[model samples]
Target: MLFFSQFQTPFWFSSCFSRTIILFVFVVMCCHDDIEAALVLPNNETIPAIYVFGDSIVDPGNNNNLLTIAKGNFLPYGRDFKGGPTGRFSNGKVPSDLIVEEFGVKDLLPAYLDPKVELQDLLTGVSFASGAAGFDPLSAESANVITMSGQLDLFKECIKKIKAAVGEERTATIVSKAIYIVCTGSNDVSNTYFLLPSRRSHYDINGYSDFVAGYASQFLKDLYGLGARRIGLLGLPPIGCVPSQRTLGGGKNRDCYEAENQLASAYNAKLSGLIDDLKTVFTLPGTKLIFLDIYYPLLSLIQNPGKYGFEVATVGCCGTGLIEASIFCNPTSIPLSCPDASKYVFWDGYHPSEKAYKILTSTIINMHLKEFF
Candidate 1:
């Protein structure tokens, strides 16, 4: 027992663990601060916080307080989130959770709804995003949930909490230094253009496209006004390919709902244009405001699944991909999904699988992080 004391950390990882502990102690003693980084690359530069915006893809737990149908605080949803409930969509960790891991901080980002959080928690930052909103302030409202504008209102309260904890000047530095990740627009495309009969019947395709673009523009300005310096805006992925939509619209017989996907792509293109225009309009200097093209990246994966090691990319990992989301979504109320969850690209009708998330996260870290960081 005495001889094995030094190796008690585990034979395979003892040396690495010791070295990591020492490096952590060394850095903690000297560095000004460290934050939950979003990249896996060896960039030791520390920021103050990460303030997230937009919808479910990146939201930690903002929906905990909302009465939205698009919530994930219940069963099998958190089966993989370790021994406790965390309100994340995935069985375990989402992008925010992995992002915090990349930063070397294993503690989950304090959910804005968690009553146990104190002042320091607010200083480190929190997520105010809802599951169904994006550039559209009315997106969440359409579902009778919280909107992007409503999220900003929550952010105002968060800022006040942060100001009290860290002081206004340091709070400014914290907000300015931290990266802001905005992920949304999928729900809007799914709900508005395709699902909602109201939108389809009233406005022609072009008119609705114009509405999405105009709203997206104002959304960026709102973030800029709130002191977001470094921003990473994500565009919507291939909506026509999502299992639910494919099953609903044409039953996946090559009769894809092209109209919806085109609108999504068009909105994404307009978003890119608006980001380019922001340099002149917002006059942002010394801080980066960038767009991460999640649409194209995800599209390539779906188009060439063999390249990504995916055998079946057309349907979901859940039951039949059509009503599969409803099945696996609330297992206690409904039935559990199938056993071969890994075979499909999507975990449900709308979300990606663990394998897909790993691929996407690695791509962002290895490929596009230099531009944002």
Candidate 2:
């Protein structure tokens, strides 16, 4: 039987907060009778594997071995995961793992950089994503993590290894048949342009969006050139609404920053259009390029948390919830972290909670699984 702890709120909290907490607890108890049942894949459409590439949102733990502050291999980061943190930038599985799990591919998608990964694991899939990496070259550079180009290079190396192990024919089937998920662009908008003044000096929001979109288009084309036929490119979420952004730019009360959200929406529009154009441009016989919109779905959850069995949307479950991620959100912050991550939309200042990710991944798969075929 699934169990949910009662929602706890201070007495000084407003009546609205009390009502929302009650609603969240009630909804979780009644709607989610069995936690595993909620996670069961809606369809049995299994793929050969799931290859993920991009930023912290999809990164399983590629940044662990790298000399970067973006690492998440520590306590509290993966308190809910089976083994431990494993460098995933969430309280549990990130979207990369959830994607594979929901598709009946595997329980966890190991990082390509992980030393324990073997030939059998390679046959399934692996994430080349690095925490803090983004489409903008400067974005990854600033964080000292792997660049998008670097990830592609790793993918090429992975292909060679697979070919060596299973021969060219089998390797080709895996590479072409597997679902390739590219989740990026959030850091490009949130950190590269907004937080850092370097890009903003040259390009306004419009120009910057175009700049990142161009890189995104090239990356997809390159992935196709490397044998990925079915690709899912994720759009940026409502960046300004995240806890970090809310604290940084959302004024004294810390409301969702509209300017940042506008930038994200603009970029999403360009990315969606580019995906359609790329499909028409790709000469490959079976090219499937899809733009998965995580913007509105995440926005809805943030706007109305109670509707999704969550009470806290503005703040994350980690630390103060305003600004703490990666190394900053460490074991020391565990005392400040929320006891029940399921009731919060975000695990840290940036990434979503496992529950939120499960819901998002399920929605994406159910809506677009047929399109891949």
Candidate 3:
């Protein structure tokens, strides 16, 4: 007994200590993939899904299959994406995709038009945005792109599929719990109102802004009818500051078109009031409508590029960003793109780069998304 006790102490301690060290290493290696997944998927995810809408700013790849010039399913566009050229407008991810990553819902939000997208993907989330789409029907028509109404129709179809897959009860929960983000209206201002001259001739800038706000309000009401409870509506960014607009319309100095800036400001104010009215109108106990002010945030990023670690604020990385966009942003035609896209705020004339998007989303999360979580 005495000999056994003395031998047991050393034997047990050495065996247990070695086993613990080996176990620790083994566990860490075993969780290698899980650790990576966790980095993208936060543990504190509160939303069940994130449904996104709007123009190129949020379109994943819906326009990839569309027969429009607003497509981006080619090189240099998705140069930084995993499989490359997934039809996102930026060098990599867009605002909606980054927001989904921020919410820890999914690494990539599938485009509703992507044939590979499965029922499971829909249950999680999807983007119904079409590049070049706008609240104004004419803006969409001009680009030969799907209008906001058409996108809403697609959402209706999506709902039907969700109901078929998970039944009505689960579908309702998903729709209610999901976060809906809208980032349209730039095209309405840039394409329809300012460039076209039709709307501009009829309604003054203020009247035109009010007209757009009315349409925007109707859009939210339509979503509410579809069971969307939590909403994030991004106001217009500085459309005047976009490289394409500045080049085409900015006259000699190439300064941001002042009249266009005034138009955006006027529209934004009306839109803010519209959002406030929407909250009261959408009276579903927990319905939350958040109007994200991207105008100032984006403008500040442009005015103070160094503050945000960006070198170029006016031009994009693809070709002569002063004019290139969509098909014009083709790598074949340009034969070269900026080696480093992170330094540039705009990806190609209009859209923000993935780095710019990440910064914008982080700011939005810090400022407003805290309540949602």
Instruction: Tell me, by lDDT, which candidate is best.
Output: 2
RMSD of 2: 9.9
Per lDDT, what order, best first?
Answer: 2, 3, 1
Candidate 1's residue-wise lDDT over 9-127, tens digit each?
A: 00000001111212221111112111122332223445566666666666556677766676667665555567643555555556655545555434556567677777776776676
What's the distance in Å from true for residue 43, model 1? Answer: 8.8
Candidate 2 residue 54 C-alpha distance from true site, Å: 0.4
Poorest lDDT segment (10 consecutive residues) of candidate 1:
1-10
Q: Candidate 3 at residue 184, lDDT?
A: 82
Q: List ranges where model 2 is wrong by over 4 Å.
A: 1-46
Q: Candidate order by TM-score, highest to lowest?
A: 2, 3, 1
TM-score of each: 0.81, 0.89, 0.86
- Per-candidate local distance difference test: 0.59, 0.75, 0.72
Q: How would you encode candidate 2's per-residue C-alpha lDDT over 1-373 as one tens digit per residue?
A: 0000000000000011111212111111235521221322223333677787888877878889888898889988999999988998888877777656644567888999999999888888998987777778998899999989999999999999999999999999888777787888777777778878878899888898899889999999899889888887777888888898899899999998888889888888998899989878886666778777677777787888887788899999998898998898999999999999999988888888888876666555544554554
lDDT of 2 at 67: 86
Clash number by candidate, in order:
2, 0, 0
Candidate 1 collision pairs: 80-92, 81-92
